[model samples]
Structure formats: C-alpha cells, structure tokens
Target: MGRKAKYSYEFKLRCVKQVLNHHQTVEAVSELNGCHHTTLHDWIRFYEKYGKKALLPRKNKVYSLPFKIKVLEAIEEDSLSFSQACLKFNIPTKSVIMNWQKTYKKSGIKGLNNKSRGKPKSMQFKRAKKKSSKPLTREEELLLENESLRAELDLLKKLQALIQEEQSKKRKP
Candidate 1:
C-alpha cells in the first residue's frame, strides 16, 4: 500500500552521464535531480561496472530453491563475484545474487523458499492460540486459579486502601 519510488532507466543513464561526462559533482547532480547522492553513486557504480545494460528494467523472476542452491554452488566453486554472477546469469541486478548469497549462508537451501507474505487474517489456525473446551490439566488449573486469586487480591488491596483512608480521616476529625 506504500508508494514505491520508480525511476526510468533513461533518467538513471542521464544522471550517470552527467557525473561521468560533464564532471558534475554527484551530490550536486543528485540534489538537482531530486534523488539521493548514494542512489546516484550506486547508479554510477553499476554503470561503470556493468554499463547501461545493468540499468535496464526486467520483469520479476521467482527462482526455485534448487536453482538458488545451484547458483550458490556455482558462485562458490567458480569463486565468482556478485557482479560476475549477475553478468554471467544476465540477472537484472546484482542485489538478487547478493541476497541469494546471504540466504544461502544463513539458512543453506531452506532460506531460498518463498515465505508467505503479509499478516494472517485469522489466529485460529496459528499454533500458539489452540484453546479447547476440554477440562484443564492440574498444573493449568492451578495456574488459572492462581491468576483468579491474584485478581481478587488486587481488588482486596484497593478496598483495604480505601478502608485505611476512611479510618485515617475519622481519626483526624
């Protein structure tokens, strides 16, 4: 639901060119273009490293865990850099390969699995909230009774305080 910032490849190219060809300061160029200097810096880096092709837009691709593992293995075996992998695989961006590398390291093959996005609508199916109508176990009953006693004790404390205040007022009078 949040607004996503989208920039055309041409705009990025122009920004990169301005920095590269015109000798314009990255900070000044980015400020004039209404984009951050770091964004411009990244664009320049990508342009310099991978050329304009790196800035081109591509459709989203969902990679399977097997494919992810394979790519990770290739990267490890070949000692390929993230940029090299992106170049060799024709990946839209280097970040995809970097993310895969991170996932591979953190969770091996399992991390590549696509997790379900967004909050669940219902808690009934959730593992934690599985209350039943069955009679409570002894320990559970004791805990329940202890909670009940604590609530009563709290109420008694408030009443005791009120009684003590009343007695104190009468004694003062």
Candidate 2:
C-alpha cells in the first residue's frame, strides 16, 4: 500500500481560515481545496474546541492507564464490542485496546506504563548470566567492557597487518 497522506500545518491553517474567517461553507471550501467533507469537519471541530494547537499533527500518543482501564471497563460493563468502543471513543484502532487488555491481564496496571521497547545501549554485549554467579558491580563491569573493546581493536589491527603483508607478497610474486 502507498504511504498515508500528510497535510502540513500551513495548509491546514489556510483551509481552516478560509472556512472560519472568509464565511465559506465547509463543503464549498473542501471542494475548492480538494479535501474531503469529513476531514474538513474534523478540522473545524478541532479549531472550534481547542483552537490552533489541536490543528498540529501528532505522531506519538501516550494514553493514560486510567483511560485504558476506563475504556476496557466500559466495553465490559456496557457489553460493547471492540469496534463499537473504538467508534464511540474516537479511537484509531481496536488492536491498541486489545493489546492494552492483554498487558493488563498479564501484569495488571504496571504493564501499561510507557517504557523503552528495545535493548539498552551499552558497549558490553549482553549475554545470559550463569545462575551461580552474582551480578558484576558497575565499576567491574566497565573495566571488563574496556578490556573487551581493547582486545577487539588489537585483533582488528593484527588482521589489517596480515592483509597488507599478504598483498605485498602477492605483488612481489
């Protein structure tokens, strides 16, 4: 599928201004600007309610735990399906709510917290710890990491020298 269409802030502002200040109907302005009726309607609603701040496009959405629980509870108590809840609450997708439900079931409310989704950055490679060994102290770990990096650099230098020696031997022959 093609990438989703993105509208710029200036474009949105100009379109919204045409409808708000110029006394033009949404339908007429939308037709003139080649925007759909529903998109224009949503823009008008954002402009009316939250002013211009709401008009800017947002990439990241951080939903509160309470909101997630409330939505799930509403679905349960009201006997509404995922699609129904999504439409009623103006949510983008059902999978988001479903994932939240799964996390809630596995780890209760704590799983809903926003955390980094990948491995932490460290020079030391991550390996499985032996059950009998205690965890290394921070300073000791840093020393080990330094030694590992130094060894890696030394090995690379040796390989480079060996490659140059081989090239020289080939040229001479």
Candidate 3:
C-alpha cells in the first residue's frame, strides 16, 4: 500500500490546466495555489508525458531485480536524466530510481533484491522462556543475590534523594 496523496487528482489537474491551457507561468500558478513551482512543473511534465492517468494515485509496486537492473543500465547507457528515465520507465517518482542507483552502487545486484516488507520472519516465531529443571548453582545464586541487592540500593538512594529534596524545600520556606 502507498501513502495517500497530499494533492488530489482534481487539484493537480486544475493546476496543470492553469499552466497548460491558461498559458499561466508555472511559478505564478504554483504560488497562487500555495505549492512549489517545481512541483507544478513536475505535474505538467507527467501530464504531457502520460496524459491524465499520470495524475491519479498509484499503488505501491515491487519492481523485480532484473527490471531494476534494466532501468539502471538504460539510464547509464542512454545517459538519461532522472526525470527522463522516470518518464520512460513509467516510474511514479524519480526518487525510486535514485534509491535504486544508490543501492546498486553500494552493494551491486544483491542490493537490488526486494526485501520482504513489514515485521521480520525472526520476530514471528517468539522463543518461549524455558524452565530450568535443575536449581541454580552457588555462583549463579550469588549473582542473582547481588543483582537484587544492587536494585535495592538504587531504590534506597532514589528515596534518600527525594527525602533530602523535600527537607531542603521545607527549610527554604
């Protein structure tokens, strides 16, 4: 699933129309609509390249590793800009290509593999706490006793500080 679009299709269409049909400057239309000029320019570009359908919200897509490599190769071989590559590949955003390029550069083909989304597989199967059949050894018992003593000491120190703070406040008054 993809995040909901901040701008509605109709709103984008209206902005694009204002620029293309009304012949208004991108900056003027964008400023009037309380959006960035570059954003408006992108809308215009998508509209010109892919028609009205491009303005609609797209579902999250998982590109295969081969397809990812192909897109990267095309960009490098054809010397395509991010925007041009996006338009050619029908990618919704340029950031997708940029991220793919970064991943490819850092880790090669293995990095391009689509990682499983959401909670990891390890988290799904929780390890249940096993009850020990035998009693704790003498050293183990000492360690547990020491931990309890440390906790008790910390609690007493906190209580002492609170009592001191209270006494100081009363003395101040």
Question: What is candidate 3's local distance difference test score?
Answer: 0.92
* Top candidate by TM-score: 3
What lDDT would candidate 1 get against the real structure? 0.81
Query: In candidate 2, which residue pairs get closer than 3 Å at backbone N, Cα or C atoms, i.e. clash?
Result: none
Worst 10 residues of 1 by lDDT: 121-130
Q: What RMSD does each model have against the real structure?
A: 10.1, 9.5, 7.3
lDDT against the true structure, each candidate: 0.81, 0.80, 0.92
lDDT of 2 by residue, 53-123 (tens): 76776655778778888998999999998766765665645788899889989998899887775678778
What is the clash tally of candidate 2?
Answer: 0
User: Per-residue lDDT tens digits of candidate 1, residues 1-173?
Assistant: 43343888899999999999999999999999999887687778767777888787655667777777777787999999775676566565678888888877898777889877679777565466568989889999899899999999999999999999999999997
Give me candidate 2's TM-score against the actual structure.
0.48
Top model by lDDT, which number? Answer: 3
Task: Score every model by TM-score.
Answer: 0.46, 0.48, 0.69
Q: List where candidate 3 sits over 4 angstroms from the true fold.
A: 121-173
lDDT of 3 at 15: 98
lDDT of 2: 0.80
* TM-score of candidate 3 on Cα atoms, chains taken together: 0.69
In order of TM-score, best first, we have: 3, 2, 1
Residues 35-142, candidate 3, lDDT per residue (tens digit)? 988778888998998999999988888999989999999999999999888888889888999999999999999999999888765656769758699999999899
